[model samples]
Target chain A: MMTDYRLTSLAKSLPDTVPFVGPETQERARSRLFDARLGANENVFGPSPTAVRAMAETQHWMYGDPESFELREALADHNGITPDMIVVGEGIDALLGYLVRIMVAPGDAVVTSDGAYPTFNYHVAGYGGVLHKVPYRYDDHEDAVALFKRAAKVDAKLVYLANPDNPMGTALSGAEIVEALEYLPDGTLLVLDEAYLECATQNIALPLPLDDPRVIRLRTFSKAYGLAGARVGYAMGAPGLIRAFEKVRNHFGMNRAAQAGALAALEDQTWLRSVQARIAASRNRIAEIARKNGLRTLPSHTNFVTIDCGSGPEFAKAVLNEIVARGVFIRMPFVAPQNRCIRISCGRPAQLDILTEVIPLALRAAELR
Target chain B: MMTDYRLTSLAKSLPDTVPFVGPETQERARSRLFDARLGANENVFGPSPTAVRAMAETQHWMYGDPESFELREALADHNGITPDMIVVGEGIDALLGYLVRIMVAPGDAVVTSDGAYPTFNYHVAGYGGVLHKVPYRYDDHEDAVALFKRAAKVDAKLVYLANPDNPMGTALSGAEIVEALEYLPDGTLLVLDEAYLECATQNIALPLPLDDPRVIRLRTFSKAYGLAGARVGYAMGAPGLIRAFEKVRNHFGMNRAAQAGALAALEDQTWLRSVQARIAASRNRIAEIARKNGLRTLPSHTNFVTIDCGSGPEFAKAVLNEIVARGVFIRMPFVAPQNRCIRISCGRPAQLDILTEVIPLALRAAELR
Candidate 1:
């Protein structure tokens, strides 16, 4: 007789599907590397040379300071907040998982935009939370008002809103989000993910007080700082909520070299400015390429552009598949109406040249299919 | 009115205590750094130069291959097992958290030895698992038979055992552990933590079949491999049990450079052997110092030694405090019997010289107090 492992009902109930299949997995399946990698919105511009040097020079034989005191202090100073208000972790993805575990018990309600970041939904499901998704607006922006209203209806303990939203590259202004807060239920805590805040064209920092218990904001080094491989991200919130992470977090989880890298990266504002400029230029180049292919592009407040394939979800998926087949990697939103578009991350001029060369061909092939 | 951010009942119930207060925290509290850093069982000889170079040379821009395919494949080849049977994470701490989350639900029973690794207990409590702890044997080894018997009696879903145990620096042979397995109940799973295996003088790798569903063994790059700061560890188990980690793990949580560093470290068998020799020499030196100071040192099979203070827990703690004040960092066990001894990690020659100078003074101060 076989031994029964006896996994928890929640674990057993979880589907085998992951939120996003990595480009590396796809490359392995196809047995070829992508010539122009743009699918995941990674900053190809890379981290500051100073940051790279710091990581290389770190004493990696020692465990990272479990409290991540130095990095948290640096982040606090950079954000104009006290160190107690910040909690650093492996990444925004891991932070989301921790937050979901803390807030959502079995059968608890959590709210998110239907086609927003799927990783948040994955965490909710992993924790046995019942997710209630509100659809994106017709303009392809996350409907914050609708999300808050639904949270009220569902009595959700948590509501997720990504400013400068992913998948569609659209965003709501800070004032607009603040106005939407009125609709949020009294007990629901809003998770405002600003992973791409540094990459946005406009200053999108919310004007809410730092001690506001109604919301917690997440930030990452993976975007404009170009240290995604370092796996460093942080949550800024009320001191009480931030202190709660201490109860269950893997205290020594931070990589020493990554912490050093992030600290150095945060100090290099010149590098950040240059990367932001490059991203702006690349976004326009991608839009130009989409226009030449007779496709419309969504106005972006992020590092990626969402191109309307001018048809249904099938057509958009075909376009993505064709691009992947041609050694250019990209992704599309999963849910419909938004699924009629494909998302393309900003890249260097050389990578953009490949995108320029491949778009029309991919479109033709996708249309034929 | 203040906003009510509702945390789950489990989250609210969790205590503020952490698994281990990092040595850095101590240094900060003292407003001075330790002259000899021997507290945490971190390999002071450091990771291989080749590993360091590999990390420095890695691409920090790209997010690590979320599947960690190359590293996993390398690990599989090294262990003489298929890649599917392993799951890599940020560290053993995170992996343990994920494992406990999968097998344990609120009020589920888990078993571990009293005065075993607190991190495992922390994970159990984090998930609301009811932990049943059996006392350590008088010989200072983890009482494996007692643990299994308790697991069976409590109908535990999981039982944790660390060979060449921490805080005590004692060991039971692989054969002894295999023999003790007979006491384990049919449905109970064993978590065999081998974090210090590479540091052990004996070949303690369990001889059981690799596909045994009853056991999952965790290994780390943090000890003899000296990549504790890199935060890399892997779990080996039956394929079905390993596959379940996918349902909840942070797939993209690895630092890219850490993966590169660990792969390079694994390939450098010469560096590992050299570190092993150093650890052995350091252990003998530590025992010699303890003997000179009129204290009894436990026979160690690990990178650290536990020295009996020739008195009670209070005396041992006073000795630890004096050592810290004297700028030679060291620790002691938290629970009774074991708490009568102080633990010290193997250090470099210069560091050991500092320890030699500090130990006598610390003992005198402790006795005087």
Candidate 2:
């Protein structure tokens, strides 16, 4: 029964589950900061020193430009698109929430892979949308075909795909994504999340039908440029969909410091390249460490590496717990099968050293148990 | 006629107007930045230097604590409440949007003063709430009693009141708000916006019923603490309503540097007091300027002063436009007859000097036109 202060029926129906548990919560609960902070896929290498300086120099008394005019212009130049095609926001998480709200109504169908970004699913649920989850193929990449088919079958309003995906650190190439877009249902808009796309640092033009109304790409300063805390992300699409976002978005939401930081970071591509190289090195190191412990790693195009624990979800959970107890913070996928592998983000050498030392120990403890 | 991607019917039905246009947009159009930035009511005194240092020192690579654990603990202590009773978000704007989303379903009623914060009314309309506007009484102050009566009559799910109000520089005391709470409908929740509360800086115990569920009070670092660009704000209320925010809020939405900056800013109460004093001085300067111009100044408890232009909104608009054209940025109330007044924020001495120079010129230009 609905009680005092009548909440929307959709709100009352939502469970009290947060999209992700912040690592700081764990730190507070344990009464100690993690010795090795590698979870949540943060770039421990940090933002460009130039960006930090620029952000720090901002007069915090002034509200940021609601239009994000300069940052969007910079990003448009960076991505070879017109400024009108880009809409910058607090983060991709927020943009996804806004997208879900605009597109989904009660019982509206949305499709995604079963083990895709939990936050996307969280937003869909929050908006009271019916979610259809397609499983991964051969325990690797998200099944694009199944996602397309499901959207068509259910007449889903939206479909979500993250290139260089999180958790599993697997991806669909841009060419593959472009081909799949043709198969999208006539009524469905595809949300192509590229938050991790810059991890490769290739600077190669990703094949995009930017003029297409059916697809929009999400990118962020969080990954390679390392401004996750600044919470700046953008969506690229046709002008119509871009303008539509202005209808529902928190227009005056940009952080003034973040706008400066993002602009500076974009200008400093040298730092991003270096961070990508470092993430690449760290990923290889993690794979090497896992291989030494008789574990196999899924090939990754992103910052993190996921190692198959060769047991079950139970074993992976025990190992993850042990690693946490050993002063390292790492996460794993939520569902079965993928849950058999623990996800570790790229870390600095000292933090990776902790991981280098702890995996085997965690494995032994889990085995003993 | 449903087209290629079905927007939520509500989204499709909404108008495309934004709540407020940023001053930056004005600057961009004019092809020059404003010489005096007084329109938004942001503190010209800026945040504590320690906060700038703390924010600048943040590792921008990591997502902020979704829990906002430390900030909440600090705020809880600061406010004499438990941490659970406070929920921090991107800003008071985002919190208000979230509150309206949770409380008002499509076609539900909401109540507010006729010329109150446009953003709140915008959010209510965004969520498809029917708004009942209670006009100002006693010539300037929002009629709190009228608002309560209208809300009860319309059975509004939500009611918004800005203490130390915006635009008109008027207020309803905490005790007055408490009395209003008693008259609220059974399911109505009052959104008590205290964005300018610290403008007083007197530390008088404003008779707030902080423990009451019927009222949720908003506080922000945007005004007195001079972190408008940082975008940090909080809601204080019953823990249940606080936790309900989790179901809809972007959990990791905070700027990491903003979180740090806020904590440091809070620790530096000396800086806050100093800024408040500056604001008071600026308020006096503005009043003096208005008096010199033969305009009446509304008694202000907030950082900005609303000056009666001694004419209708049309003359105020012409004066306001003349100010903008002269390279000073200022705003007026959007609704009538409140629009008869032009709102000016407390500025730095030089900025106020520009305002003093411009007001007479603006008045002369408006008269000539």
Candidate 3:
């Protein structure tokens, strides 16, 4: 007899596709490791040595504090808010998934920039929520006002805005975001992903009240703090909204060492400042490389720089493929005008040296193609 | 105007309460740390030194492989299955949540023992699944046959069974489980949680076909391997069922160091064997302590022992409170008949000495109350 493992309609409806394939997957497929792992926007400067030692010294036999009490307390202090205002999770990805689960019912509308974070869209779609996308602004920043207007039109439950946005690597100032918040509908919650905020050159933090119910800001240790492998990120919002996470979150999901690592990373401001300097220097190096190759680089507010390939998506795709073939891992945006650009993460000087050697040759190969 | 976050009806319905309160929270409330950390059934023997070193040496800057390819391959080899048949997740709790989300739509039927893992029940309720509970057998073993029968009656999409059970610390043999499987309905999936299987003395491993679509077996490094803080667990099932996890799982969720730690933990079977020996000895010591205190202990197959308090839930609760007041952290079952017993985890020799010193005093206090 045939056994029926009855998957829910929503589960069956979701496509069996991941939002982003890891570079390691490509390495296995190609049977060779990349010389420069500059694709995933990982901080090449690494986490604080103090944080690494902290993780190493943690007691691994016991379960992490399910409440993540100590880590949340540190995050609150770092952000100048009370512990009740924060909810920590595996990362921004998992946090986004939880937020979507809490707010989006099947057939509910959610709004985001057309080419912003695909992971957010993946979460929205996973929950059977309808997505209404607004195009980016002419300057390549997320058009938050347009997104808010669309949210109002669709009566969307959530509107996602990634300040210092991914893929395009351009950002709107904090003042610009505050001005745009006026257009958001009263019922809509803004999921402001500040994942790259620490690396940005100007308007470093969003100036919103800690108790603002209309917005939930996300921050991560993955980029500037350089603890991506630790899988630590947190959401700062109204205490009531933060408390609601207790209803659905995996209480013991956190890795204990990660909590210790993040707390130490947060406390070590010197390491953060050093990493920021390195990121800035590397961003300039990438822009210099792009200029030498006769390609224009977008003004990046993130650890990665997006370069205009002087052609369409197909040419940029060829360039990316050629770069990968030459053993320097890099990626490109997935949609329309954004797809016309190839994004390169800021890397260590040695990794950037490899990128410097490969890009011109890759461009030449793309031109021939 | 009142701001509305527009949480889904389901979200609003869920109680803002966590399933298990961490010992740290209690410590905060009491303003003192427990002298002996025996609650939560954590393996006090700790993880392999190799596993701890592996995690400490891992690159903390890069994201863990989204596929968790290396660890999955290691797990597959260890389990005598192909990689496609496995899915690694944050922990069993998170995996159960994902399974419930996949199988149970709103109002769909699910089955479990009435006082089984509260986290599973929490997931079912969070997903809006209607649960049909079966009672344990008189000997305190999970009633698998009765659960399958109830699943058939309710047309449950899923049924959860934790072999080598929690709270009661009792288990059915693998042969008995196989015998009971015949009663399971064709459409219902069985979630066989074998978290404490490594510590059990008899019927140590489940005897089931790897390709069995009717069952998904969950294994964790948190207990015997002693890596609870790492939050690593794997599910083994038919390839199709395992692949379905890709549709909704946070692909980038695994902590890199955790993946390394679990992999090393899996390789060190010598460390695992030593831990199992320690657990067995600790269990015997705990049982002896209860017997000396004029209390009977349940036959335990897990890392914890359940002691009959010789009264009702109230007396057991008072005993537990008194024990806590004396600076020993321990827990008890949450339901009737079972609640008449207090649960104590297998602790180190030093920790058990403290338990020996404290139990009589605690019992006397409870008797006076």
**Per-residue lDDT over A94-181 for candidate 3, one digit per residue giving the tens place of the 0 to 100 score:** 9999999999999999999988899999999999999999998887878988999999999999999998899899988888888988
What are the Cα lDDT values of the candidates?
0.91, 0.87, 0.91
Q: Worst ten-residue run, lDDT, model 3 chain B?
A: B1-10
Clashing residue pairs, backbone N/CA/C < 3 A, model 3: none
Of the candidates numbered 1 and 2, which has the greater DockQ value? 1
Clashing pairs in 1: none
What are the interface RMSDs of all the models? 1.6, 2.4, 1.7
C-alpha lDDT (0 to 100) for residue A363 of candidate 1: 91
Binned by DockQ into CAPRI classes (incorrect, acceptable, medium, high), candidate 1 is medium
DockQ of each: 0.76, 0.67, 0.76
Docking class of 3: medium
Give all candidate RMSDs, comma-separated: 1.1, 1.7, 1.2
Locate the minimum summed-lDDT window of 10 residues in model 2 chain A.
Answer: A200-209
Scoring only the A-chain of each prediction against the true A-chain gives TM-scores of 0.98, 0.97, 0.98
